[model samples]
Target: MTGRRRWSTDEILDTAAELLRTSDAESFSVRKLAAALGTDSSSLYRHFRNKTELLRAVADRILLAAMDGYRPQGDWKQRIAALALRLREAFGEQIELAVVWGRYGSGGTGSRLVMEELLQALRASGLPDDEVPVRYHRIVILLASLITSEAGINTVAPKEYEQGMEQFRVAVLGADPERFPALAHFARDIRPLGADRPAAFEDILAAHLAQIEAQLP
Candidate 1:
């Protein structure tokens, strides 16, 4: 390479995110990212103290990018739903990145803003002050768990796993109705794991909202 461009911190984070999206976490490293940027790994250390810092920075950048145009409007539940949908859409693009965000936490300005916004939205739900923290943690945990699970499923090997699941469903459907009536009856609705991720996510969110509503004093 002739003249290596002097990358800014933002540039480094952006490039790092790109690298992460293209590669698995196990193979991701400072050297690989530096090479991708046409610079030495040492250059990144100036912007990030270590790999953990770098990963967190990249994750935050991705989150900010995802929520760039998001605005919390409508009632509390609607606002929460909108924010959740935005997050899901963002994580859905590079589900693997969610693990990184979860590992170190979204310790960036974007995350702070999101946290504040979420708190505000949750408060609008009419929950007592004492219950806010617990409900907040629950919603955040649900989001992370669902995102990670969906990401893991998306990374499943080849396409045979899905085919195998379908085969199993067919087999179950063929079972004797007397012995396995429930399974036989639901066979047609049986979907492969993670197949209904969007619906499942929504259901979880709805459940959380319902719980909050029920507990409101």
Candidate 2:
């Protein structure tokens, strides 16, 4: 009976990764994955204890892919930026996974390695051991929160995301000139929201790194 199983765990994970490309996290299920493999759900259970475990593995797979083939380079700040962006790009490649990243958090060895790398980068920045915890927490939160939130803008549902963006654009365009001076004044310039995200992310990340640099010994 056990000899009937032909799929390897890696194969399952690979197929699951592909499944993530087309399906949002909300709709992803072990049963769906099994269906994709043309097998019963029990086949997956033979390899993964439960959905949560499989999801955790999937998250680690993403983190591992981000870390693989990456080498630390440049100044400490630049190194941090490169690493963060690498992680972001990995999620960006699979927009649906990025959409659900917030829910699972999905701690793994790869995630730990990323944090360790951050701590090392902080050390390179000349930050003192005493300040490591607070500073590390700030960097982690800044990178994770901003990256995932940006991904979630497209959300789990296409119609919902579109509807939300339309309402947001309407508000931005409709705000009273007197009460919302800055937004009103810049509304026209902000017309290209989609095009500005990369620049916005860069500017924000630059400011954050500068703040950390000021604290260095």
State which candidate has the highest lDDT: 1
**Once model 2 is optimally superposed onto the true structure by TM-score, how far is the C-alpha of residue 204 displaced, in angstroms?**
1.4
- Predicted model with the maximum TM-score: 1
Any runs in candidate 1 off by more than 4 Å, and if so which? 1-4, 163-167, 170-185
Clashes of each: 0, 0
Cα displacement (angstroms), candidate 2, residue 71, comes to 1.6
Q: In candidate 1, what are the lDDT values of residues 20-47, reduced to their tens digit?
A: 7777766889998898888998878888
- Predicted candidate 2 versus true structure: per-residue lDDT over 65-137, tens digit per residue: 8998878899889988998888888887767666555567667777777878888888888888878778888
* Worst 10-residue lDDT window, candidate 2: 190-199
TM-score of each model, in listed order? 0.86, 0.83
RMSD in angstroms, candidate 2?
A: 3.0
How far off is residue 198 in model 1, in Å? 1.5
Residue pairs in clash, model 2: none
Question: Model 2 off-target regions past 4 Å?
Answer: 1-3, 154-169, 178-182, 191-195
